[model samples]
Target: MRTRLSRALPAAVAVLAVFSALPVSAATAAVREPVPYASPVDHPSYIVTVRRDLDPADVARLVGVTPVHVFDTALHGFAARLNPAQVAALAALPGVETIEEDGTASAG
Candidate 1:
C-alpha cells in the first residue's frame, strides 16, 4: 500500500499542478473588452507606441496584424490597420504605451 501511494504521489502532484494552471491560462485567454477608436472608421490606422523593451513588429503580430510601418530609432512603435477589437487587445498588452489614430500633420 505504501509503495503504491508513494509512486502515485509525484504523478498526482504533477497532474494537480497542471490542472491548477489551466484556469489562470483560460482567464488570460478570455476575450477583452473592445476599445473604441477616437474616430469611427471601418478599419482605422493607428500608431501604437510601445515600451522600449518591446518590439513593435512583435506587438503587431500578437494582435494579428501586419504593421504598415515600424519605427525603431526615434520612437518605439508601429503603425498598423486595426479594428476596435484589435485596439482593445493591443491596449491591454503590458508594454503598450499609447494607441492613437494615425493622422496627417501639415505645415502652416
Candidate 2:
C-alpha cells in the first residue's frame, strides 16, 4: 500500500547512513609530501613555477623566503634560495606547477 516515494525514502536514508559512517579522511584528498631534489650547493636556488592565478610572492612567503626574481611574462613564478625542508614544503603546496634548479647558460 506504500507509495513509490515512501518505499525509496528508506533506501536513500540507509545509503546516506552508510556514507556518513565512513572516515572523514576517506572523503578528503591526501596531501602528498614530495622529496626534495638533491643538490651539492648549500641552500640551493630554484625556480618555482606556480599557477598563473596564484601570486609568486605569496607562495614564497609561505615558505619563509623572498623571491629573488618574480616573473609575470612568458611565465608566472619566482626564483628563490631554499633549504631542503623548504624545497619539499614548496613542492607539496597547491598551485605550484614545477620546481627546478636555477642554472645559467652562456652563449658560445
Candidate 3:
C-alpha cells in the first residue's frame, strides 16, 4: 500500500489547488456586453430617472454610460446620450426608476 499511497498524495494536493483557485478565476471573469450599441436613443438624448434611494453615479457605473446633463435637487434623474442597447442596460440597472426619450415640443 505504500507505493499506492505515495502516488495519491500528489494527486490529492493537485485537486485541492485547482479547486481553491476556482473562485478567483470566476471572480475575474470578463463581463459580457449587454448592448449591441446599434441605434441611438431618441433624438440622441434620454432622461434617466434613478431610484430615490441610491446615488445617480452608482447607477451610472452600472449602466456604463456618462450623463451629459445632471438634474439638481429638483429632480432625480439625468440626461444622457445612449444607444438602444445602452438604454436597455441603463433600464436594467438595480436602482433605475425609469428611462424616457427627450424631445422637442411645439407651441403653436
Candidate 4:
C-alpha cells in the first residue's frame, strides 16, 4: 500500500548516509578536509543589542569584529560576525542586553 515517494524516501536517506560515512583516502590530493553537513566550521553572524550606557560600536570593537551596521532606535544594537568564543565573551560584558543570530529574514 506504500506510495512511490514513501518507498523511495528511506532508500534515498540510507544511500546518502552510507555515502557520507565512507572514509576518504589520505593519499587523495585535497588540501583541506570537508566539514560534514550536520556540523559547519564557519561562525554565524549575530545582532547585538547593548544597554543604555554602552556604545554598540565599541562593543563590536572589543570583540575584534567590525559592526556592519549600528542602530539607535528603540533597540540600540549592531551586527557583527561572531565566533563561538566571541559570543561567549560578549554575553559576559556588563551592559550587553541581548545577543541573537542575524538570521535570514524575508518580508512579504
- Cα TM-score per model: 0.58, 0.58, 0.52, 0.56
* Cα lDDT tens digits for candidate 4, 1-108: 657997899999999998878777643656777863332248776889998788889988887888878988978989777899899999999888899987656999
Which residue pairs show backbone clashes in model 4?
none
Candidate 1 lDDT at 50 equals 98
lDDT per residue as tens, model 2, 1-108 = 657997899999999999999999887758677876554466788899999999999999998988889999988999888898889999899889999988766999
Model 3 stretches with alpha carbons more than 4 Å out: 1-43, 106-108
Candidate 3 local accuracy as lDDT? 0.76
Provide the clash count, candidate 1: 0
List model 3 lDDT by residue over 1-108, tens digit each. 256877889999999999887887586688775864433535378878887777776677666778877775877878888788888888677778888877766999
Off by over 4 Å in 4: 1-41, 105-108
Residue-level lDDT of model 1, residues 1-108, one tens digit each, is: 257887889999999999887777686787888985453457888999999988899999998999989999888999888999999999899999999989867999
Cα displacement (Å) at residue 77, model 1:
0.7
- Candidates sorted by TM-score, best first: 1, 2, 4, 3
Clashes of each: 0, 0, 0, 0
